[model samples]
Target: MIEELAHDPQSGAPLSSVKNYPGPEVGEGLADVQTQAYRTGVRTPEQHPLVEWSGTREGTLTNGELVSAQRGLLGYFRRTHRNVRDDPDPSMDSTAALALKRLKAEAPRALDSFVWYALAERLAAKGYWAAWMLDHVIARCPHPTQRVDGEVVGRCGSRLKFRPGVGKLEGVCAKCPHEHGAVDEALVEYIGDIYRASFDEEMEARLL
Candidate 1:
C-alpha cells in the first residue's frame, strides 16, 4: 500500500481542498516535528534515530517524500502489531516490537486514532462494517472442533461474529440479532473524509 501510494504519480492535486476540511487536529508538537523533518530531510536523532532510508537519498525531501515516509512508518506499525498479536514471543526483541512498544507508551491516544483510521479505510473499501451486539459478549462456538488430517484445525457449525477495533473484541458482528447492519453510510464516508484530511494536513503542514 505504501509503495502504491508512493508511485501514484497523480501530483496530489485532488487533495488541494483537503486544507479546508474541518476535523480533529494533529498534535502541535508532532506536527512541528514532522514539518521540520520534511523540510530538513532529517528526522530528529532523539525522536527517530533508528529510521533508516532504504535508498541512496540526499538533501531535503519534498512534501510527497515525507508523506511516503509517514505512510511507510504506519505500514510498519500495522505489520508489527499483527505479528506480535498472532505469535507472542517475549524474548523476541525486534526493532519493530520496540518501536511499537514505545509508540504505545508515549502516544497511546495517537496510536488508537491511527488504528481506527486504518480500520475505517479497510472496512469502507471492503463494503463491510461491524457493530457491538451485546453489552457483555462471550466467544462461543456452537459446534465442536473439527480435525483436519488428524490435526484439530477448524470448527464446524459456528456462527462466527465479526470483531472490530483493537486490543479486544470491543464490537460484535453487524448481522447480529439486533440488526446493526454495518456502519452507517454517512459515517463511513466521514471516515474517508477524515483520512484524506489527515493525510493532506500531514503533507501540507510545512506550507502552513
Candidate 2:
C-alpha cells in the first residue's frame, strides 16, 4: 500500500501506513524454515536492521537483512493464516482449489505448491486471517502515530510502511522516538469490508 496518514481510533485515530522502498538487494537463498520450526514470535528486518542507528547513518539493507525480513513476513503468514484444523473440512468441497491458487499468487515467497497446505484453508474465510488480508487492503490508512523525545513532542509529518500487527519496531522514522501507537479499528474494519466484497464476489470455495 502507498504510504498514508494514520487516524485516531477514539478521535479518528490513524493507522501507520508504511511503504518502504523495496529492499535494496535481491533476496538470494531460501527463507530459513529450520529456524522457524522452533523459534517463536515474529522476526523482521524492520525490527533488527542489524546496524547501530545513531540517527546519522544512511545505507541500504544488507542482503541478509532482506532475507530475514522476507522470512519473517512469511513466518507471520504461516502463524496467522487459517487451516483445516481450524475448519476441519471433512467433506473437502475445496473451493480450496481456487483460494489456494490465489494465496500462492499473493504470497511473496515462492516454494513448493504444498507449502500453502501448512497454512491450510487460507482465504476460506475473512478476518480468520485478518492481518494477512490486511496486508493487501490497508491502503491509505487513517491511523494515528507520533514521535516523542524527552519533553519534545512532534506530529509525525512523514510516512513509513506499516506491518499489520507488527509494532512500529522498524518502520517509524528512526529519528522520531515516541510510542503508544494503535491501529485504527474502524479503518481496519473498512478494509476488511471491501476485501470481503471482492472475496465473495469472485471467490467460490469448497466447504473444505
Candidate 3:
C-alpha cells in the first residue's frame, strides 16, 4: 500500500509529492510504520503545508476562534511529525494506530475520520501509553472537546469555534448563550466542512 501511494502518477510519487525527501527510514526500528503514519495525513506538503489559518488575528469580537484553534491543532500535527521524524519510534506508530482503531470502533457513526485521526496523532505524540489513556478519556467525554475559541470576527459578530458538540460535552460553552458565536449559520457550517476535510487529511497522513 505504501509503495503504491509512493508513486502515484498524478501526485508524482509520495517522495516527490512531499518533496522527494524519501520520508523517514522505517525498518526493524519501526521507521516504515512512522513514515506511513505521517503520509496518511498529507499526500504532499505543498497542498497541506502543515498549518493554515482560516481567520485573521486582526478581527474584532471573538470570530471563528474555533477555526483558528483548529488551525493551531493542524500545526500541532506538523510539530508532531517533525518530532517523530527526529526521534522515530515504532511504539508511536502502534499508539496512533490504536487511537484510530479505537475511535473508529467507538465512533461508528462519525461522519468523518479527520477528528479521530487528529485525536490519535495528538495522543501518540505524547507517548503511546499517554495516548491510550487519553483515548479512554476522550471516549468517556460525549463531545470530546473542552471548548471553542473564535478565529475570526469580521463585521459579523464573533466567529466562535469549538469542536462539534463541545458545548454538550462539558458545561463550559453551554454556560454562555453565545457558545456557537455570532457569525452567520452558513459560515459556521462552512467552517465545519473545512475542519471535516482537515480531519480526513490528518488521518490519512498518520494512519498506519
Candidate 4:
C-alpha cells in the first residue's frame, strides 16, 4: 500500500491519501515520499526509505515514524512509556502498528526479519556501529562447535553484534569469535526475489 498526502486547501496540513500499489518499486515510492516528505523525509538515492511509515487503523493518524528512527520515540521507549498517558506528540506511531498488517499480506510470519527494538539500547547509544541489522529478533550465531584441543563443544549459538553504520553490514559472533563479513552484501543478492530494502535516511541522520 502507498499513501500520498495532499495538502488541505483550508488548513494546509498534509493529508494522507492511500492507494493500492504493488511491490516496492523505486520510482513509485520516491514519488509518494515526495508528497508526504513531512512525515519522515528519508531521501537517499542509494536506498528506499523504510523509516517513513503509515498504516490504516481506527483513530490512527496518517503520519507515523519507526522507533528505530524517531528521536522522540527512542526517548519515550527509553523510559518504556511509563507514567505516560499517550505517546509523545508528533511521534504518533500508527506506521509501526501496521507492521503486522503488511507482513500478513506478504508472508504471515514465514520470514525472519530484523527487530529494530531489539537494539533499542544500542541504537539509542549512538555508537559507531549501529543500524546494521537484518537477522531475527534474537539474532545468534549458528556456527558449528569447534574444539581447540578439547576446549569447547556443541553449537556456537552466541549473540552476534552487528556494525552496519561502518559503511558495511558486518556481524561478529560473541562466543565463537567468528566474523561474518558483509552480511548486507549477502542479503543484497536476494533483493528482487526474496527481499526488498525499505530504507529511510532520516533514521540514519538522527544518529549522526
Give me the candidate number with maximum lDDT.
3
Candidate 2, after superposition: displacement of residue 81 in Å? 11
lDDT of 1 by residue, 1-208 (tens): 1111221111211111112222224223457745553344321111122233333232222233212233334443333334335653333224333333434343232322233343334333334321211111222222224566884333221223655545554333323514432333323354354455434445557887
Q: RMSD (Cα, Å) of candidate 4?
A: 18.4
Over 4 Å off, model 1: 1-53, 57-66, 69-74, 82-84, 88-189, 193-208
Kindly list the per-residue Cα lDDT of model 3 for residues 84-177, writing each as its tens digit: 4666555654455444444434433332223433455546455543343222211111122233475321222221234445355221222232
86 Cα displacement, candidate 2 (Å): 11
What is model 3's C-alpha RMSD? 18.5
What would the per-residue lDDT of candidate 4 be over residues 37-152, giving only the tens digit for each residue?
Answer: 43443211111122222332222232332112232222222232222434432222333333323332333222222223323223334332223232113444434356677733
Q: How do all the candidates rank in terms of TM-score, highest first?
A: 4, 3, 2, 1
Candidate 2 per-residue C-alpha lDDT over 3-24 given as tens digits, one digit per residue, 9 for 90 to 100: 1211111111112233233332
State each model's C-alpha RMSD to the native.
20.8, 17.2, 18.5, 18.4
Question: Ten residues in a row with the worst lDDT in model 4?
Answer: 42-51
C-alpha lDDT values of all predictions: 0.32, 0.31, 0.34, 0.33
The total number of steric clashes, by the backbone 3 Å criterion, in model 4 comes to 4
TM-score of each: 0.21, 0.23, 0.25, 0.26
> Which TM-score value belongs to model 2?
0.23
